[model samples]
Target: GKFPEISLDDYECVMAQVERQYNIRCYNLYRTYRTTKVRPIHVAPEDWQWLIDNLWSDEQFQKRSKQNSINKSKQEMKSLVGTINIETYEVTLVRNPETGAWPSAVDVWRAIYMKANGTWSIPNGAEILNNLEEAAETHKERIAAAPIPLAEHFALVLGRKPNHSRGVGIGAVNQGAQERYRIRARAEAADQRASDAQNQAAALLEEVERLT
Candidate 1:
């Protein structure tokens, strides 16, 4: 019996499927599976090890991966419409047959907002409708001058940032904020280490004086 030779295209297709299935990419996937001792369904343990040893370990790849994460986090306006993405919704939108004009982001948001409105206990929820109406009018005026995305429209009109922590409405994780939090956590750890070292030194000095 002989194993079939895997081509580059086959390898790439498998990797694509793995990414889609797991919602994770190379380095992170390696880290997660390695630490957890949980085997990935698609990748054999030996193949996973080979991938780690060969590809994910490269310094340039790791650097690029980190930068990609940072770049992704900086994108304030997440183009999501519930389970479906904005792009999919855009394609499905009923266009004006005569004008060939498509529905704007705000128009899509309004529909999403209606469905989600009753789910979460929004702060001053009753006033949201009034605010939305006002925002719509403002958005129309603003767009007449210059166009903006729905997330921006929400921020400008309704005063809601497109981060889940701020409020609910097709929001995304604020990656920059999360990065800042990690920085602060690291600083706190350093401070704790310094304090522990100082305390240990003091204890040693007291012990030496007692011995003398």
Candidate 2:
């Protein structure tokens, strides 16, 4: 009679026996059955306790979750490696109290000369001096290397000598020509020195890497 076709209580006991033997909880079985076409069933309290004890171990989950969070934070910081804030100041001149006027040409020129000579004063003064020095140096070099005596050539072309020419045109053509050639030669030498410096710097980097 198959033991009167086993009562529901008897079947549950058999299932519980199998669950214990396999170290699986009965709550898992109930959940699996509930997902099927079967009507919903409540998990037994004992089975629910068994599932909580086995699956919801707090220590293991927290360690893994914390490690993942730390790794993500490190990655975010690495992405911002070169991001930084910088401050800069702009130099500007104001009216001179004593002079009661804007800067004079001579004052501006002096500032420029000082800058080129690597001398510095106040921010405004240093900026102006640097610019002036660069311009004056460039002009002086150009004049010194002109194909002919600059003042004399200007006198010839303009039909009158510059106001303070010092009669350079009548003084020494040969000497002026030599000076022009010397200036060009010096410029070439300076360019070569710059190239050598760049090469040396590159070599130093390679040497450092090799030593390391």
lDDT of each: 0.53, 0.43
- By summed lDDT, the worst window of 10 consecutive residues in model 1 runs over 164-173
Top candidate when judged by lDDT against the true structure: 1
lDDT of 2: 0.43
Please state the error at residue 42 of candidate 2 in Å: 99
List model 1 lDDT by residue over 1-212, tens digit each.
49766645445555655664575555567667557957588878898787778867788877877796664454323322434333234335564689755455556554544445344233443465566567667667764443223434445544544463133232323443233334445656889899999999999999999999
Candidate 2 off by > 4 Å:
1-146, 149-152, 158-172, 207-212
lDDT of 2 by residue, 17-130 (tens): 475456444334534543562432575666655645664345785476458556434322111123111000001434577974544333533433334555543345445445
lDDT of 1: 0.53
Clash pairs for candidate 1: none
